[model samples]
Target: MRPGERAVLLGPGEIGEPTVDDWAAWSDTLPHEVVTGLGARLHRHLRPAATTTLRSL
Candidate 1:
């Protein structure tokens, strides 16, 4: 990992109740690193595109 390296953080299945509170309640279910590893980067929590993720920031 380095500066300008884009990483799309996504969940393979339903990570939570589509809300932060629900997820936090059972935070153990999620990988511990998911919370601590994020820095000042762009993050989009959504379903990944079948081909490529194209959208407007």
Candidate 2:
């Protein structure tokens, strides 16, 4: 991997939710920028005219 390169992973679909405290604890350990960036990038990639994701950025 190199700078500006992203690695995406797909998780299982049948997962259960955690308790409020557990969810809070887990979320506290994450990087907000990374989470939001991935979401924004995915949204761009899914746009109706997004034929080539390479330029989605």
Best by TM-score: 1
Report the Cα RMSD per candidate. 10.3, 11.8
Model 2, residue pairs in steric clash: none
lDDT of prediction 1 = 0.48
> Local error of candidate 2 at 53, Å?
50
Candidate 1, pairs of clashing residues: none
lDDT of 2 at 22: 46
- Predicted candidate 1 versus true structure: per-residue lDDT over 1-57, tens digit per residue: 999885534443353323333344456544444455446584655664456646563
lDDT for 32 (candidate 1)? 48
Q: Write the per-residue lDDT of candidate 2 for residues 1-57, one digit (tens) a residue.
A: 998774333222124434333433566744443345445446333224334335331
TM-score of each: 0.25, 0.20
Candidate 2 Cα outliers beyond 4 Å, as residue runs: 1-17, 29-57
Instruction: List, in order, the clash count of every candidate structure.
Output: 0, 0
